[model samples]
Target: MRRLAPLILWALACSAAAAADVSGRVSTAADGVNVVPLAEGSVIEVVLTTSGGEQVRTFAARDGAFALAGVPAGRHVVSAYNSRFVFPEVHVDVTASGVQAAALVFNGAPIPASPLVIRPAGVAQYYEARKAVDVVGFIKTPYGLMIAFSVFAMVVMPMMKVDPEEYREAMSSLRGGDGGGAVEQSGGGGRSGGGGARSGGGMQPTGAGAQRRQIRDR
Candidate 1:
């Protein structure tokens, strides 16, 4: 149960397809450490949002593997967050084509929720991304796996948008990169993920969610 979210997110994130191959090695934006590939029993998460504020997506990381699938082609906000480690928000764009080699970095400091205005979505992206990279960067040492897998991903939200247990469970298995989870439709027209985890299209995107609020006033 606890590990499900990351495992699912990783499987889904790696599953994203595009007009071209939507695949590349992951690394840290700051230092550029190549993130290890996803493995079994590893949990990771990411966040994604659109510029138009239309779609938002979340992903899971398992065994150091993760993915963001079923996203609309355009420039969008891709943030990195985690409940355990500290990182900053990075804005990236996907083309009508797709996303290629992107690195989500851990800023190594606590990022307050006030900035994003959305807690879990932003925080989770960092945690997941940090964890994913750390897992792969492990260099076997006399001590053990040379690298420390656990970075400092702290959860700071008080009244979370989702349940505490879920948030924690999601957080533990969570980390965010622009917050995009592959969407699996209940029924099928062009539905993907078939009984599998899908992208985060259904969830109101942070940018779009904010936009809707503005529209109502106008």
Candidate 2:
């Protein structure tokens, strides 16, 4: 029995280290008011990612309030979603002794939940129905597609190659100038005048006097 004393203390320490609690209220904006509590059945899911792996739990709010106990201590992302709304993910750190609190506010209404069904189905029909429902769900929503496309464009568009000549022509058209006409004319005149004058030893721009004149002109 004396040998068991050390094991008992280690067990108690592990239990304490794994203990955590989270609580929150779910609310929505009301007319002329800051916020109004949501109805019961709003679902809150907390996802904990630790060195051990990821753990998930779901809790339903009662009268807009919810509490989840026995969560493992670490950092977690809490996401609240329901038939009417979706809240942004909230980040919280869970300590052994304190409760992590959250206030979730949702702006836009989400797709309504399907009605409950109790009818039995064959194996093939069950899979077919589930696949159809999932496809419909993906098609009926625009947010996921929009976010994916936006991210894809931001990442891939920069890596795509654009023809320099095409870009120059487009800019010239926008500026009411011919593609290479303006560039050729201006560059030729500037080079000839600057190069000839400098080579003829008439106030070469390599000296301090030319710099003073340029600064005064600016």
Positional deviation of residue 44's Cα in model 1 after best superposition, in angstroms:
3.6
The C-alpha stretches of model 2 lying farther than 4 A from their native spots are 1-5, 30-52, 100-218
lDDT of 1 by residue, 149-174 (tens): 33212233333346777776677556
Which candidate number maximizes lDDT? Answer: 2
**lDDT tens digits, residue span 1-218, model 2:** 99999999999889877786665554444332454444464443434344356665555544445566676776655555554444455555566764443222233322211210011111112233333347556745897688778988999886676788988878879987675787899999999998897787864545878789889999
Name the Cα RMSD for model 2: 30.3
TM-score of each: 0.29, 0.35
Q: Once model 2 is optimally superposed onto the true structure by TM-score, how far is the C-alpha of residue 162 displaced, in angstroms?
A: 46
The lDDT of each candidate is 0.43, 0.55
Residue 135's C-alpha lDDT in candidate 1? Answer: 38
Per-candidate alpha-carbon RMSD to the true structure: 50.7, 30.3
Error of 2 at 212 (Å): 99
Residue 71, candidate 2: alpha-carbon lDDT: 69
TM-score of structure candidate 1 = 0.29
